[model samples]
Target: MPLKIYNSLTRQKEKFIPINPPYVGMYVCGPTVSGESHLGHARPYITFDVVLRYLTYLGYKVRYVRNITDAGHFEEEGREAEDKISKKALLEKVEPMELVHKYTNLFHWAMKQFNTLDPNIEPTATGHIVEQINMIEKIIEAGFAYVVNGSVYFDVKKYAATHNYGELSGRVLDDLLETTRALEGQDEKRNKADFALWKSAPQQHIMRWKSPWGEGFPGWHIECSAMATKYLGARFDIHGGGMDLLFPHHESEIAQSFICNHVQPAKYWMHNNMITINGKKMGKSYNNVIKLTEMFSGIHPLLTQAFSPMTIRFFILQTHYRSTLDFSSEALVAAEKGLKRLWEGYENLKKIKEENFDLPDDNDLDKKINSLLDELDEFMNDDFNTAKVLANLFEIVPVINSIKDGIIEKNVLSSKTLHRMKDALTVYLENILGLQSLSQNNETFDGVMQLLVDIRKEAKSKKDFFTSDKIRNQLAELGIEMKDEKDGNISWNAV
Candidate 1:
């Protein structure tokens, strides 16, 4: 099946056709390294990670770029942004650059825990100040931006007159002008619709740099447009971010490119819906956010218990990208149970004996399984419907378990078919969907555990009740658990 992606600009799913066949370039808006990433932050990165993974699966050489916003953007007008990093430094009593580095490393750590693919290039707004300046110059040269009090602002009216400024987002230009808050920025910009390109730095601001526009910093939206174009060229295959950015942030990016290069920057625009808590946005202002580390450690007030990053990944994948995923402890618990059973069944399938897959083959179960696997490409191709694909996978857990229990057939499948299915399941679960089992104890630990279990079983068989119970009770004190299976064989797992 051909890959299809829902284009945020077009507001419809379209066949994915790369600008250059066999090669694709994608850019995603990454975190601003001002603070620790939160649960709300995981959606877009995971959304695009699977996009990158599946494109690679489809045999596309994909170069994925996601930026880190280290250069602080304007939080309000007339006042310098308490520089995102500098302000963080002040609060934490550290240097601004140190704060930036700290959070950047933290974000990377969180991404690593999530099993997200590292982008081909992680351009930083601070590092690409020159590219941002150049892009601002081009916009100025093209008469779509003007300087005011040392600050540069995009001329929204002119750009909108020439190009469809609201193409990427459905926001009407007039509505923006009408509804724009009459704030301090109203005086600096020519119109309410205009946005910052390069924000002039005030004396109070310390993160200033010498630019063509005097000592100033690039605007929030300008950083992405500049860096994406610099690394991925003026036009790329896919650009993605959270839906919150679809309006002013991503909309301005399109306007900037149209004004300077006379074209949209990306062929595909994808937006993931927000992760909400109690039907409200999970944000700092909302005060309901679960910090990524908090979620990982189960230290957040909102989380009922701790959840592994893999369980979180599975929970996210069970929902469509464009749908609001309500934050719930119950939902995560369900996902954990589902993943545990699914993964355990899949693991056991590896050791199952295959005398003859005839019974299942006679029922055309292999064909049915293949048919489901075939639809994975179709589901993923349709704007990366991870939810549907995951649901399809969950539907087969019973079949896998039945095979492991010797209740289903595997003999009919040739080695190639069996291997293909296994690979598909692993790739989708681990690589694309980014799900992994909780890290298990090391081999040495497992060996000791097995030895303990063997000794306990031997004691039980010989009716050495005191010794067997003592070993079991001692291990339980150390948080080890044991379960005796139906066959009287003892199985132990670490808690």
Candidate 2:
């Protein structure tokens, strides 16, 4: 089946046809690096990572470009034009780039922990100031932008006269012009709907660059338009971000890019829904934003325990990308258990070898297994419905477990069917879903832990209470917990 994706632009699911077949270009808005990334930031990155993975899996040469906003992002839109990075730097008593470097490295570390593939081109806003300036100049040359006292502002009223300014956002131009009231200090703009292309830097502003208008930095929306155009050409295949950016940020991007390039920036626009906490949006004002560091370290008040990156990834995938996912300790713990169970079944399926060749002893069971396996692709093709795909995988898990336990003979499935099942499980779980084992990835650590488990088992068998207690206590002190199962099997997990 051909892949179908829900386009936010059209508000419908459409077949994904690349502008250039056999090649796809994708750009996702990266984080503003003034502060560490939070739980709200994880949804878009992981969602787009899967999109990139699946496109490549389908034999498309995909060039993924995700930009870093290290400068010129304001604290709030249309309120005060203070740069987010510069304001944070002043409060922390550090250089703007220093704070940018620190948070950028931290964001990279978190993405690595989530096992997300790095983008083909990770452009930074500060690095591409020249490109941004050039784009702004072209907009001014086209008579769509005007300079006011050393600052550049896009003429939204003028653009709306000839073009659909709020098409992507489903907003009416008249309503916006009527409702948007000018703030006390923003009287320089001709219309309240006009947005900043470039802001003039004050004397105390640290992050400033020379421009025709004056010494200033690019606006939040212009940085993305400039970087995406430079890296992905005049127009790209897919442009994605969180749904919250649909209004002023993405709307302004479309206006600016269209004025400069004479065409829309991206062919398809995708957005992932936000992650909410306690039925409220995760934000600084709500006091519910959980940073990635606090999430992994269990230092946040909302988290019950430290969650592994894979568990969080699995949690996000459990819901459709377009649906809102609420955050709670209980929900995450359920996801943890679900991922653990699925991983066990996956490992067991991998251990089954097709050494014995036989026809299906049970035709009905064989057909059922193949049908479940076949639906994996079908679900994913239907707008990348990962939640449905995962549900089908869970249905197959019992079959794998029954086979492993000898309740169902492995010979019931032909060699070809068994091999296909194994391959499908591995591909969907590890490659497409980007999940990893809950245990540590180090082989030496595994070997040492296995040795300790064996030693503890032998001590238990011989009734050597002292040695077993010492072993368990020492391992527990090191944050490892060994459990004796009812089946006389010992398993260990990191605390």
Candidate 3:
């Protein structure tokens, strides 16, 4: 099946075709560096991270660009007020860049913990000020931007006259203009509909820069349009962001790029549905967010218990990206158990060797496994219906477990079918999905565990109750909680 994507621009699933053959460009809006990212932030990135990995796995050279909004999105007038990052730093008495650095580092660490593939180009808004300035200049030279009092504003009314301005987000220009009432504090802008291209900095603004518009920073929307065009060119393949950004943020981007470069920014306009908590938007403003760290440690008041990064990953993957995922402690606990059971089956598939199995001359195991594998690709191709793909995997899990436990006839499978089944499981589990076991593979760690187990075994053999219980208690505290079998061997894992 050909890969299809749900384009927010078209409001339909369209076949995905890269602008350039053999090379694909993807731009995903990344974390804003003013604060630590919450669970809501993880949805879009993790969704597209799989897209990037799957594209690469299918032999496309993909350039993935995810930006860092470190120094943008702040108040522009009145008291020379601080930018978001700067304001937070002042209230906390930390250096401005220190906060950016800390959050940026934390975002990276979180991505690593989730096993997300690093983007090809991770640009920062502060680093691309020159590019932003250049784009602003182009828009001005093209007569689609105007400057008033040293601050530049995009000429949205003028741009809309020529371009299909509302084509991307389905916003009607006339209604928007009619609904936009002038706010009390805005004297510099010619129109409320015209957004900031370059915001003039007042004396109090800490993250000020020298721009064509005196000392100011690029607007929140302009930074992305500028940086994406510079890194990916006038147009690219896929542009993904949250569905909430489809309005002012993305609408402005389309207008700016069309006026400045005479082209649409991307071919596939992908937007993941919003994450919700108790039917309300899971957002920073909503005050119902579960921070990624809090979710992992189960420290937040909202979460019932701790959840591993992979459990969270599986939970997200089980739902189609275009469908809203509801958050609850019950859902997370269910995901944890589901992932553990799935991984156990995958491990068993590895342990079952073809040599030990009885086989017919031409077993149909290959056909069965091939059908499942084909469905995996089929669902993914159908607008990235990840939920369907996961359901298919669950269908085959019982078979794999039965093969390992000798509950089913395995020798009836031919070598070719066996090999394909193994390959299919590994590819889907590791390569395309970008998921891996969240456990260390260190030999030293295993050896130490064995030694401790041996000590406990000796204690049990010697009838020393206190020693055996002490070892068990210490390991449990360390998350190497013990699981003993009827045969007397002790197993442990950090869950």
Candidate 4:
């Protein structure tokens, strides 16, 4: 089956056909870099990372671009065009670039922990001031933009008369005029729905840049349009971001690009659903955002314990990208346990050595293995259904365990099928899903643990119960769990 994607623009699933065959361009809206990234930020990065991985796996030369909104955008759309980064920096008593540097580094760290691929081009809005200005000038020359008091605003009413301004968002012009509230600069705009392309920054604003209009920062929406077009060209293969951006941010990008380039910016528009906490949307306003650091350290009031990065990744993959993934301690714990089971099975599969034997008595098990392996690609091709692929992989776990436990003979399946199973599991788990084993083997720690396990064994042989129990109790208190195996061997793991 061909790869299919649900384009938000068309509001339907369409077969993915890159405009330039064998070479694809993808642009996903990146972080604003004004504050620490929270759980809500993880979804889009991880979602598109998998999409990029899959495309690359299929032999496509993909140039992925994700931008950083460093030149702080406004607070509220129709209200005072105050820069978000500048205001936060003022309250914190630091330079605007200082804050941007702090958060941009932190955001990169979080992305590494999440195992997301780095974009081929990570253009910052602040770095491309000339491009943004040129694009805005072109729009103004096209008569789609008008300067009001040294500030530029897109003429929505004029653009709407010629083109459908709200087509991407499914919003009608009449309803927008009726619903938009009057703000400080509403009188300057011909219509209430007109959005800013650039805002004149006051002398007090620290992040101001000199533009044709005046000393002001680019508006929230213009930054994306300018950066995306500069890197990905006038028309690209895919444009992606969070669903929350569909209304004003992405819709405005479409309008701006159409005015200057006379073409749609992206062939397919993809959006991942938002992450919710408990039952509500996760946001700072709700006081429910769990920062990536807080989640890893288990420092948040809502988290019962620290969750490994892979566990969080697994939890996100369990839900379809288009579906809202609810965050909860219980859900995370379940994902932890499920990932542990799968990893354990993966290790067991590694122990299945190839045997030089004749064909199996029955081909039922062999055929089933091949069918399940083939289903992995089938599920992924169906709009990247990661949950179903995971389900099928889990089904193979028990079969591997069964073969290991002697319940099924090794010769029942040919060596070729066994090798194929291992190859498939490795590719899907490590390459496509981007999952790694959470447990690490530190040589120094392992040496100490082995010494302690040896001491315990010696104590048990000498019938010194006190010493053995003391070692066990103290290690338990330190979050090290020692397991006694059936063969009298000891193993320890950090809890």
Root mean square deviation (Cα) for candidate 4:
2.2
Q: Quick one: RMSD of model 3?
A: 3.1
The TM-scores of all predictions, comma-separated, are 0.94, 0.94, 0.91, 0.94
Give the number of the best model, judged by lDDT.
4
> Candidate 3's residue-wise lDDT over 4-34, tens digit each?
8888888898987888979999999998988
Candidate 2 structure quality by residue, lDDT tens digits, 259-355: 9998999989999998999888897778789988888988887788998888899999999999999999899999999998899899878978886
* Model 3: residue 370 alpha-carbon error in angstroms: 2.7
Winner of 3 and 4 under lDDT: 4
Candidate 1, 468: how far from true, in Å? Answer: 5.2
Q: In candidate 4, what are the lDDT values of residues 1-495, reduced to their tens digit?
A: 888888899999899999998999999999999999998899999999999999999888999999998988767656666788999999999999999999999999999998888999999999998899999999999999999998899988899999988878999999999998886578888889998888889878888889988898787698889988888899999999998899888999999999989998999999999899878889877888999999999998889999988898989998899999999998999999999889878877887887835666248988899999999888888888999999999999999988877778767878878888899999999899998787877899899999999999999889998999899999999988786654477767775
Per-residue lDDT tens digits for candidate 1, residues 252-352, read: 99988877677789999999999999999898778788998999889877689888888888888888999999989999899888887777656655655
Off by over 4 Å in 1: 76-81, 353-362, 409-417, 463-481, 485-490
The predictions' CA RMSDs to the true structure, in order, are 2.4, 2.4, 3.1, 2.2
Rank by TM-score (best first): 4, 2, 1, 3
Candidate 3 clash pair list: 357-411, 358-411, 359-411
Error of 3 at 304 (Å): 1.8
**Residue 139: error of model 4 in Å?**
0.4
Candidate 4: the clashing residue pairs are none
